[model samples]
Target: MTMPEQITPTGDMTVQTENLCAIFGGCAKCPGHAKAIDCGLVHLNPDALVFCIHGCHQLRVREKA
Candidate 1:
């Protein structure tokens, strides 16, 4: 069996207003890199530099990778 993908999340309605967000280096440039939405979104945390919006979704596994 293969390992599972980690869960993640995101933010920003108008786009890259969150200059601190690293989601796609910035929400503005972020494509729908969503493997499952729950694990696709990225954000920043007060305790952690990087954070996920959700924590119950698994990312899809690419056959090529």
Candidate 2:
């Protein structure tokens, strides 16, 4: 995978502005899949990072306090 040029930190999370197609297993076989990929934002949380913009997949993160 190609690394993003810049990764900005947003509060307790960090984000990289790049195309995450490879990680998300390409675009979904749907009408709006293209649009969703184009407008999607790759978010990295404490536990996992997801490349979903249309809520296709649900990612849960549990932080141990």
lDDT string for model 1 (20-65, tens) is 2244444454433333332333333222232323222236778995
**Tens-place lDDT digits, model 2, residues 1-65:** 34343335444453222244443455564232222224333334332332334344445789999
TM-scores for all candidates: the values are 0.20, 0.25
TM-score, prediction 2: 0.25
Cα distance off (Å), candidate 1, residue 26: 0.4
Clashing pairs in 2: none
Count clashing pairs, candidate 2: 0
Report the alpha-carbon TM-score of model 1 versus the true structure. Answer: 0.20
